[model samples]
Target: MINLKEIKNDLPAGIVVFLVAVPLCLGIAMASGAPLFSGIIAGIVGGIVVTLISGSQLGVSGPAAGLAVIVLQAIQGLGSYEVFLSAVVLAGAIQLALGFLKAGSIGYYFPTSVIKGMLSGIGVIIILKQIPHAFGYDSNYEGDVHFVQPSGGTTFSELFNAFNYITPGAILISGLSLAILIFWDQVLTKKHKVFQVIQGPLVVVVLGIVLNVVFANGFPQFALAASQLVELPVASSLNGFVQQFTLPDFSRVFTYDVLFLAGTIAIVASLETLLCLEATDKLDPYKRISPANKELVAQGVGNMVSGMIGGLPLTQVIVRSSANIQSGGRTKLSALIHGLLILCCVLLVPQVLNMIPLSSLAAILIVVGYKLAKPALFLGMYRSGWNQFLPFVVTVIAIVLTDLLTGIGIGMAVAIVNILRNNYKVSHYLYKDEKSITRDKYRMLLAEQISFLNKGNILQTLRKVPENVDLEIDLSKSAYIDPDVRELIEDFKETAVTKNINLTIKEIDRTTAPTDEKALL
Candidate 1:
């Protein structure tokens, strides 16, 4: 299934994603208060191991920003990084069990409105979070996506605070990088095949490094602080590099606290993975759907391996996945190649990676963010009617105000309310022919699926049947009828007789029909 022609595209895309992912892995590890190398290890496992087993061609997995708070607290709560690794292993096992149990179908229940809201909300968050980095205020961790900043400021407050601490060199580099990215996307890519092969982000990264070097040597006033640059852990020798990999302390794996932590990680990580998978599938240009259960299994295995080697928890990350798709990755090969590239870089040229400035990467993400939450997207959603637009806007706002899961829960709640409201009014249709007006004859057709939510509506409809009217209730097309609904219909049979209304039922199961008036009483 690995096409050679696709590799031609995947190769460059892999490198582009690799460029975007390096600092993120480091920054997330830093944010989580774990060894910096663990993030890279997780990235490597996600790219190489997960992609091999995963059914998603476009979804790239890695250390998730959303899990950073949990990871930070888990490590602190569990006493040490080694013990946390054991919990991670257990989490992976739990995910594997979930996959086998066919729990992935839970993702299908997410309405399209909520999914779009997630994507747009994340997009807005990315732009907001990256602005400070783009301006060279590295007070916050690079890959942290939460609305509340670790520095005790909100996302917008951080942006305002960043203005006072701007580094001229970072701004200049980011400005040029953004311009080049725009040029590459809008101009060079359309005009030249060579530009397509060599991505704009790559060029921006190279230019950023060169610019920073120039600033450091000749223009000290314009130079970025150490915090504004990528900080990959450097190993002087092969032994030092090998020493970076840590193994989990399986002795504590079965401890009650560790087991509890594992279950928490498993549920949160799985939910994030499923949400990201849905968003990524929507972003896929080919419109290919990834198998959610297969993805859970792949993530489980990836996390197991990552934990064995002292890596952070893994999930299908939207940022990296979106970068891969935007850069033209056509298969899982791009993810695999990116993983291998990260492994190779950390071993061979981490010094070189550390030279790339954070501003350039911020610019890349800013562009990616724009693509996800465009003004046109909001306008288009607004045109879809209030039912759709309310959930979409509510989701975006909730995500911006809270975390990913909470925002999604809010959006889903709104969507469910909309469904219930529509269902309440339209559970059944009452039709009467003009010729039957004198007789008050009515034909009632039940909805395909009727639940307790329809009970009140059905009762209202039944009560409106005028005295001496003829009524027919049809259930031929209904696949399911709630117990309450069935009971109401059966009770109505007796009421119909009292009112002198002729009642006939079609396709109603005889077992659910009243056998005697005593049964109804």
Candidate 2:
């Protein structure tokens, strides 16, 4: 079904994604407190295995920063990384079961306002997290996304800290790298054929490596520290590379604690994967909708394979997916190519990857973050209405203050409140026409589905009926009315005579309904 022209477009994008992924994988592994090579292995498996099986064309999968804290705690609880790998295998099995059960529709329950809030919040977090890296302050690991640092600093405080410890060499490289990215995105891609074949991020990475080398040999004053570069473990030989892959300790596989941890990982990873799937589909220029259940299957299989090869758990990652979309990737071929590129880099030339400066990649991510959380997006959401703007802003603030899942929960709670408020007001309408000779003509029209939520509204309307008024309660179109509502209606009928009100109930089958006074009571 794929055409060669699509492949041509995806090739360049794939390289760019690979370039962006390298440091992220390394940084996520470090943050997870796992062996650094495990992240690389997961990236490879996510790219090759998940991409092949995924219904998504643009989504890229790998170890996510969202799972860093969970992974770290899990490793500590299990007492060994090998035991955690076993839990990952169990999690994959659980995900496979979830896929077969068709649990993917759970993603639909998330409100659009909350989802948009999540995207923008993540964008803000990305920008905040990468600022220190841009300034060459490597106090935190590369892929750390938490608002509060493990080193006891808040996101805002880190910015101030970064300013105090700014490295001139890193700043210079980052500035030039950002300029090149902007030029490539805005001008070069449109003006030249070569720019279409080569992405700006790739160029920035190459130039960064060359610039760092120049500073190291000729201009020592501008030389960057070792911490400012990508840090992939250098394998000396074939056996050394083979040793990087670890086997899970299956002895602890069935332990109660292990099973519990496995279940937790499965639930969290599945939720994250589904969220990213929705976000990626929204970002796709083609407006392609990926099958959420099928994505779970792909992720499950990917995690199984990754576990067997000592890799971190895999999920659909928004950062890489957004990068793929922005870089003009047309098919899953880009994801596949990026995975192969990671494999090739690990096997052939890790030194070249290490030559890449962290600042350049941070520049690329800063641009990506800007696209997600642009000022225009905030203004547009605000203009929509308070209902949309409130959740959107709350989500952004919550995500920036907490983690991704927690922020989304806060946003969803706010959205649910808005829904309840609207429901309370709009469930029914009581009005009288101005032309009516009898001013006490009250017509109450019930909503299509009236549950307990509309109970108080119906009661209030009944209480407000003036003396000698002709009240008409309409439920002709209502398909389902709750028992409590029916009882209330019956009670109102009994009280109607006391108020001297003439009440007419439409579409009521009193004979078929329960007439027991106890039932009404």
| Residue pairs in clash, model 2 | none
Looking at model 1, how many pairs of residues clash?
0
* Residues 1-521, model 1: lDDT tens digits: 45567987999999989998888898899989899999999999999999999999988989988889989998998888999999999999999999999999888899998999999998899999899899999888877777887667898899899999888999999999999999999999999899999999999999999998999899999987777889999999999999999999888888899999999999999999999999999999899999999999999999999999989999999989999999999998899999999999999988898888999999999999999999999999999998899999999999999878889999999999998999888899988746785687888999999999999999998898889988999998787899999999999999999999999999957676667685569
Candidate 2 overall lDDT versus native = 0.89
In model 2, the Cα lDDT at residue 416 comes to 92
Over 20-120, each residue of candidate 2 has an lDDT whose tens digit, in order, gives 89889999999999999999999999999999988989999999898889899999988999999999998998998899899998988887788888889
TM-score of 1: 0.95
lDDT: which candidate is best? 1
- Give the range where candidate 2 is weakest over 10 consecutive residues by summed lDDT: 510-519
Best by TM-score: 2
